[model samples]
Target: MVQSLNSNVCEERVFSNIFQTLSKDVHNFLRYKYGDNLNPKDKVQEAFIKLWDNCKNVSPEKAKSFLFTTANNMMLNEVKHQKVVLKHQQVKPKHYTNETPEFIMEESEYMKKYQRALGNLTEAQREAFLMNRIEGKKHKEIAEELGISRKGVEKRIYGALEKLRKEIDGI
Candidate 1:
């Protein structure tokens, strides 16, 4: 990127130049590979991160090749992972509860309300509650993750649940 620059890709000016020169091409390449399902921007960033991590080893002449190779390998790995997930899904038994249309509509409406109420909660309360219930983490684990006391995590979760119940159940 930096014309006639030294071999050190780690240099801030050289690295910035490289990013300015290659980011668009890299992003376009990734987007062409995955139009919507996957995040091409994330892939570009990850590729750049790999290049930065190996800056000491990668020469300016070889940086482009290294990035493309790393990105291609990552994409292949993701494709393989998706295939495995699809295979598992195919093998897994499917179950359905065919409730009445009226019931389904009512359930959907209730879910809208529930989502709105959930979003209305304070950020701390929602984070702790979701970490505990959705992630199945213990109060102690949530505390450690949030860098707060167990009591604090408990309080946030309790407050969230109380608000949700009141909003959803009209209690």
Candidate 2:
């Protein structure tokens, strides 16, 4: 038990040292990706927490890069998601104002169809679609999160969009 405790302490020391070194670059990269929308400091804390939780697998030498990659990915995902929600919210109100009752009903029906089409997609396809179309994520970022190649991400997103457009047209 004492030996185990000592090993844990050693891990903590390594994590602390590495976190201190990488926190700045991680913050800067997150800031660049997410802009002023999210707190870079909070992202650093989250990254450190993840590192601490995964300390067993992480070597001291790789800790800095791991922290940077983890934080950047998390922040990018957050930004992409928030932007999608925001875009939907923004679009809904503007189109409502100039329409008649019939037009409003038609628009709502179209939205329902769109939502249904979106729902019918496979999880990966839907995510790729949203990340590419709604969130504007690059193929590389989507690939990183989805654990696929950049080309795969691009193909999935394209395929999803093509299907969605066809479904929408039928409606």
Candidate 3:
């Protein structure tokens, strides 16, 4: 019937709108909360699928909350399983025999200083810096992930760099 077809079209449009609005937010939320343990993209996709499946029961206003909660619960279950695996594993140390003792000692000292500096940074600055530098994310990507302006991301990264330089130079 035409009525049934119209209802289906409306439901599809609503689902599409929800996906566009909350997919990135949900992905970033999972990634930020769980760090590297959870695959955020996968979690986002799974959450959206569940939302689509339960579209009749979920309202537009509540879709965001439902997606986030579902993704979080999925991540928590994954973390629990990972914890079990990690408990049974032994971590190995990396060795470099080509470097001189003095060079190695100096490098170690510098790394320690760097870590201390990083630890002293504000949470925002540290998160922005790590995402940009260590994870190879661009300023725009960092901004999106942190839900801030691109300029804000740049400022945080620059501030972190300046603080680190001062800390390391003073050491």
Best by TM-score: 1
RMSD in Å for model 1: 14.7
Please give the CA lDDT of all the candidate structures. 0.85, 0.79, 0.84
A best-first ranking of the candidates according to their TM-score comes to 1, 2, 3
TM-score of 2: 0.46
lDDT of 1: 0.85
Model 3, span 1-171: residue lDDT tens:
113332531287767877887888998899899886578899899988888888777677677888999999999888998888787675666666888999989999989989999999999999999998899999999888899999999999999999988888854
Can you tell me which runs of candidate 2 are displaced by over 4 Å? 1-10, 93-171
TM-score per model over all chains:
0.51, 0.46, 0.45
Error of 1 at 168 (Å): 42
Tens digit per residue, CA lDDT, model 1, 1-171: 535645588998788888888888888887787664667777788999999999999888788888778876777777788899999988957566679889999889998998899899999999998998899999999999899999999899999999998888753
Q: Where does candidate 3 have its weakest 10-residue lDDT segment?
A: 1-10
lDDT, model 1, position 11: 90
**Residue pairs with backbone atoms closer than 3 Å in model 1 (clashes):** none
Per-residue lDDT, model 1, residue 35, is 67
